[model samples]
Target: MSADIVFSDATRLAELIRTRQVSPVEVVQAHLDRIAAVDPKVNAIVTIAEGALSAAKEAEAAIMAGRELGPLHGVPFTAKDSIDTAGVMTQRGSPIFKGRVPDTDATSVARMKKAGGILLAKTNLPEFSYWIESDNLLSGRSNNPWDLDRTPGGSSGGESAAIAAGMSPLGLGTDLAISIRGPAAQTGIVSLKATHGRVPMTGIWPRAPRRFWHVGPMARSIRDLALAFSQLAGPDGLDAFATSAVPFDAGVGTVPDRKLKVGWMVGPGFGPIDTEVAATVKAAAEALKNEGHHVEEVHIPALERDFALDVFNKLHVMEMKPAFREATAGHEDQMYTMAKTMLSLPDTSMEDYIAAEQAAERLRDGYATYFRDYDVLLTPVLPVPAHKHGITELVVNGETVDLTYLQGATVPLNVTGLPGLSMRFGTSREGMPINVQLVGRWQAETTILHAAAVLEGVSTVRGRHPSI
Candidate 1:
């Protein structure tokens, strides 16, 4: 019963709660049990909120009293530790704030709770949400459920792992570069990095390089992503970067009615993608074409230039350094590895920073122009599948590449503030999940979600789940 309960989608759980088929207390306890059963091996959920059962009881009483219900009433969800949850440990997976608890929830968390979702736990992440792997001195490393020795992808790795392993149905996660999409790709779940400013970052950590940061949903289904996105998006008035949000409807986005124009890729533009990954993406495009949408192999040469990754790397280090230094100025010894990493970065000239911003503007304009002709852009979220945990290098098409290339296909979206999603397409020979990325123009999340939902409908592997 616990296994079945944990695997049910958030929407389904909501329906059950509303219909009195299952009490919210039953739903929440089932997940708490699931977390206890698997979290030690996966290390995904770092802290279970103390009053989860009390909250569930309240939700149950509300239903019995015939009170109005929210969209996610009684559905349990997790959030990355980097996102604040009032009265819950929001340590950001760093020792610097080991006992940290916030008075107010992050805007996204607050909105989710407002919509009737329960915050049952906080998931793990790299220190300060800084790395591409989920490991830090605070909570240790999070392992992929499909392969214990491999990574699930990071920053949002724990959130992805939790969803993949059925510890939570859906959750909130932040993406600076590949934090959301990369982990989802590796763990065989789904995640969205919405258009910049579509979701607020009011109570999240490492709120530097404000322009590139995005908060979004990581879930087991695109429908859940749409549900969570609707609740999380919109200007909160606290975060200046969170501009106006467009309305979202999962019913509309998942309907398979639109004939989309999708541009598929496997060029030098996306860095050294594995041949298999490229084929999987192309296959998705072909499947969509067969479904009556236009599909073409295209290239935007700007993405191929070294400057695409270089510019992001420079700005990320520059913006993150000052904030991290300020946060840990007096206790350098207590700083996590990633916080110390900022000190190791080469100093960037003000001219370089200016050049990077200009380049970013050009990238944004280029993507905007490209979107005029294409409805969605499809690529591999990562050049390769999840690899051994703690490894510093990865093999992309037989060539060992720097670990940073893991976020290759992803950062360009941040550079342009486009909305991008990662959905599992297939699996590697080792049974590791491989996912393709669907990127849409700014404020066009529905467009990509529609296309991805269609692809998900036709996917042979969409029904597969990790055996944790």
Candidate 2:
């Protein structure tokens, strides 16, 4: 395989295949070779599909016959193990479901396959897709491509690691609290958390509380993300919450008509952030302003007024316990400690759950009001870069904070059900990846991508691969 072909984005690869410069079989084989060489070190891919090469050959035959192709024609990609793939063992990183294989593809997986993207493998995740680190009894741990000792944030860590290492140019991931975005930030890739219910969640594990779950694309470039989004967005009829709401175009090649109005908030709403993280976000904001966008520091009033952390934990724990009970009942020995603790929480009273639901609606309304004045809101994806494996608490700017603090800036958006995108902004003094998130208005993924694309153009960190 040529070096240029291996590093090219999905957009370029698809274009090449369309024009007959390269065949689909060649492209898939190249990624397969890369994965064989590097995945042992990263532990990103849990199962390599044995039939991927044959499928690529079929795609190549269609091209030779001059048949019209789908949007992602001939591109190779991976899916998170939590998303079911027909005939493949989707262990979800836990030994509890060892050797389990679904009879049909998840809605999103089928969509990507129909678009002519070959699924090369199923990536790793936390047990039952629960934690921020991707490790479980079945597949072991997924290490960061940048630093093996540090984690690639979960539950989409495996997807991000594979894409960052150039094993695959595009992949699919689900985000509840910060799965997709956090891993993208940690791995220095780009990811989109489409508006809640915009993408179907059928066949994904832990499928309750659809309000917090989203399935979307992860890629090395914003344009490739746009390409993947075009194929994955829309209602699949299986997920009840996957409404018929059509997403606005992502504006892949078109330039913005005017300067964007951006709001910047660096630290956690409750407190200050680490100095280096704060600086990285500030630098991104300054770059946006220099590019002619109107950038200003803004406060989230709802965050200041609400017990954001407490509300998130209560709602998450209440909704997750029942699902955990059912999915892990027979395999308690295989579950993680945190997963067990969450299961032990007393069931929430109907009254308390109702009040929390009402509070969530109010918070959503508040963010709606805030977005009325600004095009997008910006913040750090996490207080620190990828932390050491198995360490939950983080020390930021001399204050000790828990893992909940890692989601401080991210969870509120999940509660509000807003669209968010995470991309690499700068590297930390420790050489870890620093990420910033851009939150857009409801169904406004285009706005976020446009801002991210602009950032990608000026930033020096774009497409910097890890050595592992």
List, residue by residue over 1-468, the lDDT tens digit for candidate 1.
677778888988899899999999999999988888888999999999998999999999999999999999999999999999999989988778999999999999999999999999999999888899999998999999999999988889999999989899999888989999999999999999988899999998889978888889998888888888888878999899876756766656433355788898877766798877888898898999999998999988666554478889877788877888888888788877777877888988999889888888777777888888988999999998998988888887788888988988899998888899999988887788889999988788888888888998999998688777
Q: Which stretches in model 1 have alpha-carbon errors above 4 Å? A: 253-258
Cα RMSD, each candidate: 1.5, 1.8
Question: 1-468 in candidate 2: lDDT tens per residue?
Answer: 466777899999999999999999989988988998899899999999888998999999999999989878888889999999999888877778889999999999999999999989999998878788888778889989999998998989999999988788899999888899989988888899988888899999888667788899999899988878877888877788888576555574233477888999874364557888888889999999999999999887777777565567768777777788888877788887667877887877788777877778778877888888888888888888888898867888788888767777777777888989999989998898898999988888888889988999999888777876
The Cα RMSD in angstroms, rounded to one decimal, for candidate 1 relative to the true structure is 1.5
What C-alpha lDDT, on a 0 to 100 scale, does residue 255 get in candidate 1? 30
Off by over 4 Å in 2: 250-257, 268-272, 349-352
Best by lDDT: 1
